[model samples]
Target: MEGQFTGADVFFVLLGAILVFAMHSGFAFLEVGTVRHKNQVNALVKILVDFAISTVVYFFFGFAIAYGTSFFVSASELSGAGSSGIFEAKGLTLVKFFFLTTFAAAIPAIISGGIAERMKFAPQCFATVALVGVLYPFFEGLMWGGNFGLQGWFESALGAPFHDFAGSIVVHGVGGWIALAAVMLLGARIGRYTKDGRPIGIPPSSVPWLALGSWLLCVGWFGFNVMTAQSLESISGLVAMNSLMAMVGGILSSLVIGRNDPGFIHNGALAGLVAVCAGSDIMHPIGSLFVGGVAGAIFIYAFNLAQNKLKIDDVLGVWPLHGLCGLWGGIAAGIFGSTALGGMGGVTFASQLVGSLMGVAYAFAGGYLVYGVLKATTGIRLSSDDERMGADLAIHKISANPDTDIMR
Candidate 1:
């Protein structure tokens, strides 16, 4: 019976890993559909390549930093071939690594959206390696891994530890904030603004593809949230239900608030999912709906504020969708994950607020320092001539649509 349960745990986490891994395709297609046709290929290439780099760096460094686990030992040791303890779960540790690596890789995927068109490939790759290797894992360990006793400190001070059922702040919040720093450092895409500073509109390349990306992300997110259990017995139908309620709430709110803009409608779904991730297991379905509704509205308002009012050229509004919403998710977990709010109570608002801010500050500072150094030294953007030519041709030496080649 113990052996059977251990095998089930392995299968469960492995499935979650596969599902989250598939979401990388969602990231690629979303970027592909959002950026101009001339830069679409670069969008696809960056995500896949960054993910590959993240895997190597995370395997060697990030995992150790976050979990204090190393796989440098013999295969038998890693697989627990002869052990009969927690380590003897038939190498379930390795499967857990696969699941968490997908989460780590999302940092680059999120950043890829914001700095899409103009950033150079190699510098961004370096950024990915450093981010997944150290910066992201440092925070991840603090929040999830009990590293440095941060959660213990939080609980001691605030009467409860910070509770993130999945990774609203740890993954999405960090990714979003980091992307903001990179985008600011990289600057807006050429002609995204006028000489007088009026924001120019850049239309999406393909709404159909964008919608498909949203669909894929929404589907994969169940695995992202539910699989946080990592075992069948611990999994909650509540998490799945809350995710659904929040998703639709985001959709409906964005549809209304965004005035039927297909882009907002599609991305609105993501904003809710991002928010609910923190407290999906604790909140009631109705509370999840409210959270989703607020997230959808926040995405519309914040995206506009970032792009138009702030003149930040975050192409997909990643900061608003992931960063801001993730911040809200952390805080909302405190609100909605309480006994008075029809939730399982073990959280505090002050703790959530502090933790969320800490994540944002850490991510922004790390992103700024890393990209700032690269900008001053190696240079992060394409040359003006290359920018005029588009990244697809300048970096990849190919266009998304080869039929245009014949016309040229």
Candidate 2:
């Protein structure tokens, strides 16, 4: 118990924990804001349930699989230094669990928006179980464990080990890829597309929810990035500040690029946050600003194309904000990472390129396989009744409907 909660340590941790907790509300409101007015309650409930499920998974198998003794740490998982995680210290295991469970919880939060207003809570629950319980463990072990882990093949050939400072790839990337798979299988929402192939724009029910959610997310993101250092180390303070810059950079840059574009005010900030997650520890604040700026601009363009042209029906923009920005974060970590900030070992340009590819491969392959199975077996798509009724009231029978006379 003492090890679990010391006064001084708790000071920092509680602050971070509280902020992270607030992110749940942020997810709820943001998702609600992006979905159509008819589905508002559905969006909020999905966020709630995802967190609830994540909490349980975290305490049970997730913590153990991510941090505890791997039931099977392959010989390849051993260190090139001849040590395997076989003898990993108990404390390190706990530390890993702390980082991983938090990370694991975030994956489905992003996915919720993609499959919003449809999927049965049960199917979604099953997918989350597979993701956190089995799928995420494999990726987590592979990326962090390296030679003394399951992904020895990657370590043997990949340049410099897989380095995701704050899970730009692990958390955001995994979420993005899985969300994509879900969105692909689920198809577009009703009336979202035309037989003529024209796209329809369905605004979210609550703009206030979107703004508030973005604000809360911005607040929690500090913990998400700073906690990557796991302590107030020599560089923790700077990393925290760097994260701040990226968040702001994403907002300001988008405003400037869009020149007061109303459609994307909230999205720009999120893009910046995602872009900076990977290299927050190593990159200078100035570099992060530029990187985040690029991410914000790219997100605006990407989102416009998806809704306007591709007609993919990404209700809450799962692709651009999470997937696209996540891709940027991995690459930026490489480009902006300086040797001084606990980043790339050297100041060379080539290292950044390598980091980008590694992040993409790690997330895409694992994410695809996990969601793919569900798509094949359980058939991940939702029935039209669920889509029309809104998932909240339809699946769980929660009465968020505006039409309800008593609530009115």
Candidate 3:
């Protein structure tokens, strides 16, 4: 029985890993298409760089930190659902590499909105390093790693165990917070706001980019949420169904929230996916959709508040869509999941709130520190000249419009 369970875990892990990989292209298209034509190449560069950096950092140390049984202790004693037997083996190492690679790639863009069209490639890449190599694995072990030793606030709240089937808190929350940190450190894009504190409209360069990227993300997220369910082959049906329902819920929610906003139309479905991710495997289909609806509302509101009210420059709306909505998923997991189906404790709305908050504080604080250092040093932002001229022409010496006078 033990051996069979182990094999199933291996299968799900690999499958989930593939699902995450598919998201890179999803993010690429989404981000690039959303930005101005002048900075298209830079947007593409940011996504690719995040992907590559994660591949390297996760392979070398992030995997060991995340799945490693023992960092201070020993490899044999690390945590999470995956087998410790494969912890140090090169083959398993490769598997962990792919799983985390997608995660690492996802984090850099939280700052994307703030730095759009102006950020230098090098600093953006460096930001990826902090999130992927330093921040992610530490918390990942704390949440999902079985032998994590449970020293943090988690132990106080969770006692012997805290469940994160597909990393609503660990993966999405962490990425969201890190992205938020980057936004804060990097600051808003030029012209994002007026002197009177009103926001200026910076429309997405292409509607196709907006719609297609959103669709791609919706598709990729299935892998992100569903792969976690493969752990129980016989019961995979329920798990996958839950994930599917959550997306439907998310879509329906978009209609309600975006009643007047086209942007909401673009993100309503995504909010649903991110919302359901944490509890997809354990929740009933109804619960999944409910969570997604709630998330869509939150995503739309957060983005507006950030732009119109707080004046935070989130170019792609990454912070609200992923960060805030992901938070909804994390807490919802505790509320919606059935302990019976999930093999853990059942949901209690309140306790789940506490769990999600813990994840937010840790990720936000850790990410802020990384950004603070970068801010204090080489400075993690672009010059005003670069901002106005566009990142491609200024940084890469390539103009989006070759017909422009400077290029000619």
Candidate 4:
């Protein structure tokens, strides 16, 4: 019976890993549909390659940094057959690594959208190595793995450890804020603004593809959130319900607030999901709805603010959708997850705020330092000629539709 239970746990986490892994396709299609046709191929390729890189790096380095686990052992030992006891029975640890690697890889996938058209591919790949292997795991250790006693400190000082049921701050917030630094360093895609600094509109190549990306992400998010429980015994229907309600809330608010703009409406769904991730386990369904609504609005306003007022030129508005919304998710967990707000309790607003802010600051600083150094050394942006040609031709040496280009 114990053996059967261990096998079931392995299968559960493996299924969750597979589902979250599928979200990379969602990320790819989302970027493919958002960027100009000339850059679509590059977008797809980057997501896949970045995932590969993230897998290798996390297996070798990042996972160890976070949990102090090492996979460099005999297969028997790794499978708990050799009595090392370093891993769980039935290879559960391996599947857990698979699940977490998908989360770690999401950092580069998020950054890929922001720097899409004008950044050089190699530098971005190097940035992925640094981010997944070091910067991101450093924080993951602090928050999730209880490294350096940070969560202990939070409990001691603030009456509770920071509560992120999923990776609202850890994954989405870190990725989004890091993307902000990359976008700023890469500067605006050429002609994205007029000489006088007025914004120019660049319409999406295909709205259907954009919608498909959102749909895929929305579907896979169930696994991303629910599987955080890491065991079938720990699973909660509440998490699934809150995710659905929050997604609906985001959709409705963006529909109204964004005046039915397809871009805003699609991304608003994502915004809500991103925000609710932290508190989904604890918050009431009603609180989740409001949180989702607020997140949807935050994405609309903050995207515009970053693009227009701040002139950040983040290509897919990743900073707003993930960074700011993720930050909100972290803090919202405190408010909405509190007993006062109909939550399961054991959370504090101060802890959430500090942890969320800490994530943002750390990610931004790490992003800037990594990309800034890359820019100084090998350079991050493409040449003006490549910018004009688009990333497909400039980097990958082929257009998304070569036959169509040939006809032209």
| lDDT, candidates in the order shown | 0.94, 0.70, 0.70, 0.95
Clashing pairs in 3: 69-77, 69-78, 79-145, 79-146, 79-147, 80-145, 80-146, 110-179, 113-315
What's the lDDT for candidate 1?
0.94
lDDT of 2: 0.70
Clashing pairs in 1: none
Candidates ranked, most accurate by lDDT first: 4, 1, 3, 2
> What lDDT does model 3 reach?
0.70
Residues 1-408, model 3: lDDT tens digits: 766666666666677788777777777777777788888777777777777777777667776787663244344433333465534332343455566567666666445544576566777778778777768877877776654466344456554245566777777777777777777777778887778888889888887876787787777776776665444453466556766777677677777777846567767877777777677666878777788778878887888888889877778777787778888888877767756544235555555677688888888898789878878887876788887878887777775556674655
| Better-scoring candidate (lDDT), 2 or 4 | 4
Candidate 1: misplaced stretches above 4 Å?
A: 83-88
Models 1 onward score TM values of 0.98, 0.84, 0.85, 0.99
Q: Flag clash pairs in model 2.
A: 77-147, 77-148, 77-149, 78-147, 78-148
Residue 230 displacement in candidate 3 (angstroms): 6.1
Best by lDDT: 4
lDDT of 2 by residue, 1-408 (tens): 544433335355545666676777887788877777667776777677777788677657765565555433543442212256453332333343444566777778888887787666677888888777767666665665452453444345544444567777767777876777677767788888888988876766778878898888888888777865544433377677778788788888789887886547787888888888877877888888887888889888888797788777777887788887888887777668866544445333444456455555655666667667777887766678777866666665665554673656
Q: Report the lDDT of model 1 for residue 332.
A: 98
Clashing pairs in 4: none
Better lDDT candidate (1, 2)? 1
Residue-by-residue lDDT tens digits, candidate 1, 1-408? 988898999999999999999999999999999999999999999999999999999999999999888777778778878453334558888999999999999999999999999999999999998999999999999999999999999999988999998899999999999999999999999999999999999999999989989999999999999999988999999999999999999999999999999999999999999999999999999999999999999999999999998999999889999999999999999999999999999999999899989999999999999999999999999999998899999999999988879798
CA error at residue 240 for candidate 3, angstroms: 2.3
